[model samples]
Target: MQKLKDRVAIITGGAQGIGAAYARAMAAEGARVAIADILDGTSLAKEIEAAGGRAMAVQVNVADETSVLAMAEAVNEHFGRIDILVNNAAVYASLQLKPFSEIDVAEWDKVMAVNVRGPFVCAKAVVPFMRSNGYGRIVNISSGTPFKGTPNLLHYVTSKGAILALSRALAREVGGDGICVNTLAPGLVLSEGVIQNTDMREKLTGPVLASRAIKRDQTPEDLIEPLLFLASDACAFMTGETLVVDGGSVMH
Candidate 1:
């Protein structure tokens, strides 16, 4: 039997890249997936449906509380309940890599809004539903950068670190309600966004691979199972944990 049968999952930033992969995987596991993103995920939703999976596209700015509330309502209205939330939306793709001292205040604020506040807003909007239903799984997407103290991406790293903290605290608060909150920190994945960033690809690829004990490129496919496990009943006893999926690069 499918792990997520009859479940309804909301995957933020699901239009493309890792988020898209999550949506597809969850849908395949028998969940009704809601693809929420600032960009249009209509085509991806259609593709999931074409592949005999259940899905819907919701255009949303995760940083906006109003948008997040509406997204939660829409998912609830369509699926009757929200069983899982993958807080995967963030402002990473178009980030301009530069020294911390050189980074603009505005740029830092934008990163915080999306990478940190986005999850905060999403959790606030969705938690009540989960609480009311007495079951929910929240998987916040963090990063491995913070573990390595990765350079030239202070804002991104700091924002992801905040996610880790949020999950830990939120897990404690919601455990009584049968809700679980955990963070998934992925390493330098060779995602579409990463691959398309010619500068980033050229600059960090070699060092990233060599640093990993696996010594191979990490892809979105590599993360699907871990994601599913956290979102499934199999992880019912687990919460307030950070699962690092960084190819053994940062073991702690």
Candidate 2:
């Protein structure tokens, strides 16, 4: 039987890279996915549909409450109910690594707005519908950088750390409503953006591989099963937990 049959999922940042991978995985498991992103995800949605899965693309700015609210409403309307949300949007990959002191204030604020505040706004917008159905799963995408205290990306690391705390607190508040909120923290993934960026690959990949117990480049495929478990009924008894899937890097 399909684990997510008839269920609806909204995946922010579903336009490309890891987020796009998540959309494809979820849809394969029978989810009606909303490819929600600031970028256009129309091609991905159509691709999923072509592959016999149901999907729709929506443009959204997750940091904006109004935009998030509208995206939630549209997904709910199109699929009839919202059962899962994957908060996978963030400003990473394109970031230039630099000392904290040299980081521009505007750049810092933009990172916080999208990476930290984005999940907060998305949860606020979608929780109502989840509450109405008395069922929901929220998987907040975080990073292992905070745990490792990775340097040169202060704003990104700080924002990701906030996601951990946010998931814990939100889980507590919504556990009674049958909503499970959890964080999925991955190490330096070689996503499309990261692959295309010579700086990120050359500077980060070797050190990341050296640190991992498995000692291989982490791929989007490595995250699929963990993500599925977290976003499905299998995770019913778990909430407010961070599942780190980075080839055993930063084990705690």
Predicted model with the maximum lDDT? 2
Go through the candidates in order and give each one's C-alpha lDDT.
0.93, 0.95
Candidate 2, residues 172-249: lDDT per residue as tens digits?
999999999999999989899999889888998988998889989999999999999999999999999999999988
TM-score of 1: 0.98
Give the Å shift of residue 41 in candidate 2.
Answer: 0.8
Clashes of 1: 0
Q: Which stretch of 10 consecutive residues in model 2 shows the poorest summed lDDT?
A: 1-10
- Model 1: how far is 47 from its true place, Å? 1.0
Residue 230 CA displacement from its true place in model 1, Å: 0.4
